[model samples]
Target: MTAMHRMTLAELVGGLSAGDFSSSELTRHFLDRIAAHDAQLNSFITVTEEAAMAAARKADEARAAGNAGPLAGIPLAQKDIFNTKGVRTSCGSRMLDNYIAPYDARVIEGFNDAGAVMLGKTNMDEFAMGSSNETSWYGAVKNPWDTERVPGGSSGGSAAAVAARLAPAATGTDTGGSIRQPAALCGITGLKPTYGRVSRWGMIAFASSLDQAGPMAPSAEDCALLLQAMAGFDERDSTCMNEPVDDYSAGLTQPIDGLKIGLPKEYFTEGLDSAVEARVREALKHYESLGAELVEITLPNSHLSAPAYYVVAPAECSSNLSRFDGVRFGHRCDNPKDLEDMYCRSRGEGFGDEVKRRILVGAYALSAGYYDAYYLKAQQIRRLISNDFAEAFKQVDVIMGPTTPTPAFRLGEKADDPISMYLSDIYTIAVNLAGLPGMSVPVGTVDDLPVGLHIVGNYWSEARLLNIAHRLQMDTDWHKQIPEAFA
Candidate 1:
């Protein structure tokens, strides 16, 4: 009971069902942790203490009546990117800082329906724009492993919260490797379901086509349970897939024997840290021991993924972010000279530096004359990257690689160098462009910093991906290792 904060979401569910702890007690324990430890991590933007306690009470009552749902009473955090009814849904920017969402995002609705307690909204990069959480207007999230280092961006707060044991698990959106990158740096598990596998209705858009919400937790098994509740079709969101979602948790114990693990030659190139590469290679060896075969595969166009992503993501973001112009529900500048001035001032005042940079780049890519040269060319490259994956999948079940070139780097180390920051997501962006499911599992550490083994699967292969990761987790303690300070 004293170490309740250390339990995974799956363990918490078991404890709740076994009557070892009431949902209210569990919720209170997490709320207390957030209150105590989150100040240092700066992971949470808001803590819905009253709503969480109320929900916990209701869950306890339902359990007593023998009508509890699978995730009933589990305390979790939501990334600020998701709209929460009656709560501030800031996208970690000044623009939405004062905006309270009128309704819950579909994922929020799903969790609420399952009677899960909403702990709070975790911080994120402003408009999900940066590779490091430093882009967040609320402030950067410090990696729990080492406060001087960053918890990877965009979904950084969610990863940091779960990694630091401030919350059992949290929701995160992956756009250009946000979820997986952060999870890897924080030594946790993150799953980015295939594009359209999860609804995007109430998720604040970054790059519409690439933004997919998923679960970030301490273990793949914990992610499976949360994904079970988070993923599915939603007519309201045209991007949501209508296909039936497999019971993700049902196959956790399924054997991954004879699984073909593909190693992309492009992912292990010059820039990769030697220590990080060694750990990833060791992870592949472990999978080989589990009866999984390793195949050397080539994603020839993988090298072009970063360049293509830079263009395509910005173009889409420019269009999507245009709605935030002062006329609507976000921030508005006071005493405007005219409509043009208002538009200029509001946007200029609202967006952070990173968001502004992306917006300008996006606007340029979509410009009339440059559209074909830049945006169209990038789209073609995206298709090539997707085709490479298609060919690789023909020979292998899943592609494996290093999630990042290195582990959690010191905060501000690359803040001024945008190129270095963008390169951090190089290994992960292609999966998003190709609309594939990808995950990051803590495999080992390099120089005492966590390294993630990247796993990518074909479309709708989330179940297989989870099974593979869970098998590895069962044989290793990396995912279970918490920062000594947090522990």
Candidate 2:
């Protein structure tokens, strides 16, 4: 890897501050890397070269004028789910392939306000629907470590780009492990903040209740920096919490002595790969060595998470996506016989298979006669899952587990099996249900694939989680390990 590519986000910030390289030079280095290698990984759908150069020059000028912020001059990729004015925010589907956002998502505005340069829009699952990135119309995002294997999705492209050093950091949204699962599989760090801790305005909705945008980066410290800028209340989103934001980077080095770590019994049962289990256990032992107490806990309703998520998420997705009917500005059919024909043909032609499947399932669950039996029941079950986390947290400060049941699986391995694919987010969905903050920290490798030590904290406990993760990272080099091919 080139010197610029090898530098972590934290190091880059210091380099920029010290005038080691101009922002234009730094942006060019990363843009060059993306141009050289992204064709192989298919990580980005758009690379704003001219815009990036212009922004970098402005950042350089701002720094020279002593008006630089922590993130100024930093270049990061954005998940296409967020709207960027004048840029096509496709959300990895052809339905909005030509749609140019007229305004920026709150997250995009935050980054721009911090003077961070936008590298490009990264790819994702179509409308953020699939567990693997294969559902993206741009094609699958290959895991940088093993190109034949899949990078976990729907934030696969963001994870891959960061993992391969294409960008120091990127934005990602997690609705049932899109951020953490991909970060775990890609050997990077990803944080899913408490629901409403970050604004959802202008972010393309998949499951409104479950989707929350956060950061993906090479290390917890880097994520801390990114999340600092991304997390805050916005009046534009009614669901956003009106709480004060924490200085995540400030607490990264805090001691974890006397910290309580809960290990949920339900997360360690059958179907978990043996290698992944071993690595997770090893990390738990390491935590014990660091003077943290580990207490066995129970989230008994964990098994119900995947099933409940499928019901509730799709139900919300069906409703949120209904606005995309051809009558408005998305993809539309030509030469329609009538309004009904236009609506039918336009939707049928625009949506991908996964998107269609979820929409149908959702519509069925929310249908008149079946509403109580499916959608209502799933919401009740969601309450049970949330209750389970509440009970567990009553006795522990944070919960720890394997982020996913396995390491990155090969591309197409579970493509034909939708049920199997859904199980990939089993360990992660409960956190979203509970509206709590969770993160993935690289702990070790399983059969050459990375494994993450999943950490879930109570609501609004992002600072504590970041500190815990940062402490662990200081003692291990797993987070610093780079893919050999990229290195």
Candidate 3:
């Protein structure tokens, strides 16, 4: 029999159903791996051993009684941004380091109801503000492929945990490229559903209109299973769509004979690395052999995505983070001269440098005199970017491109250069601005490090995207590759 730690989520489910192993045993196997290996990765913030054991035991009992849920007995990691009842929901900042959520977020509730065991909360960039996990208050998460290299952010901890086999699968949120970027850097599959596709009731907001929760795992098939439990309508969050959720796993085996793939000329421009582009182009050629047609498309406004995102995201972040003032439940200053002093000192002492930079930028952009010039102008540009995708979709079923300009870089490589770090998400930010679904699939490696092929689909087309990614995985072994140290 294959080792429990090496099995994918689906394989684990089959093992549990066949009575080859108890949920308690599988849970312990993962817990032991985390203890043995996490010292080198710094991926997890908390490990809920006692609670996880109790859940596993309950799942075993339910399975014996023939009342198991679809995902019963699976152990998964939750990103710390999601609120879990009685658990610390720090959005990776000292401000809320002591804040324990009184209720579960909608995503957490969905996973719990599906009978998944929460292994613990993974670390993340402080307030989900940076492109590399270096901005995390706890510390930067190390990439499993090479301990000296960084795992991408702000979902770097979740990505690192899954790649290292510390967890079978994990939950992640994407405000810009948080989920997909890290998954690409770590050589795993990640899916960022359309905006409002997954409820954000208790998710710590970075950009209210753009933030979304998704799944990260070993393959598109595993992501399909995880997404099935996550997608649904929730009245608690006003932004959540009332549209019906589709069975994400049901269409994984669907054929893509006449699929049209868009190759954006803009995504293949000068800044892209030669090696990375080669892998992406090769993957597109494989799709061509599968009878999928490739068409040339243009997103002319794509060059303006970074500037527009910088303005809009920070503006929304400033408004959302205002609730963390000292008078509230977060960190408060010890010595206070006055009410104003307390507010200033609390925020000054609590927030990290990257978070402070974004807050300042946001406040400036939304200030009285600059609001029309900066904020409004950024919004107009955002609309143009969205329209670019709308027009391209009329000519293609999905867009193909390189996920990042290069593979994982050494730790602290771009930490001093904020612009360079921000540009790390250049290819991914436009999708969020347009409210479309996007995913990253492992295509191949460059210099022993993994590269990802980016796929963008129209809104509510997650099922079709999964089918395409799954078909590619069937023809290649890239997604199954594991880091040597971890393996």
| TM-scores of the models, in the order given | 0.99, 0.99, 0.99
For model 2, how does the per-residue alpha-carbon lDDT over 1-487 read when each residue is reduced to its tens digit? 3398899899999999998998999999999999899988999999999999999999999999999877999999999999999999999998999889999999999999998999999999999998889999889999998999999999999999999999989999999999999999999999999999999999999999999999999999999999998999899998999998999988889888888899999898898888899988898888889889999999988899999999999999999998888886779988999989998899898899999999999999999999999999999999999999889989999999999999999999999999999999989998998789999988889878999889999999999999999988898889888898777
Candidate ranking under lDDT, highest first, comes to 1, 3, 2
RMSD of each: 0.8, 1.0, 0.8
Of candidates 3 and 1, the better by lDDT? 1
Q: Which stretches of model 3 miss by more than 4 angstroms? A: none
Q: What lDDT does the true structure give each of the candidates? A: 0.94, 0.93, 0.93
Best by lDDT: 1
Across 324-368, the per-residue lDDT of candidate 3 in tens digits comes to 998868799899899999999999988999999999999999999
Error in Å for residue 195 of model 1: 0.4
**Decoy 2 TM-score against native:** 0.99
Model 3: per-residue Cα lDDT at residue 168: 95
lDDT of 1 by residue, 256-369 (tens): 889999999888889999999999999999998989999999999988999999999989999999999989798999999999999999999999998898889999999889
Off by over 4 Å in 2: none
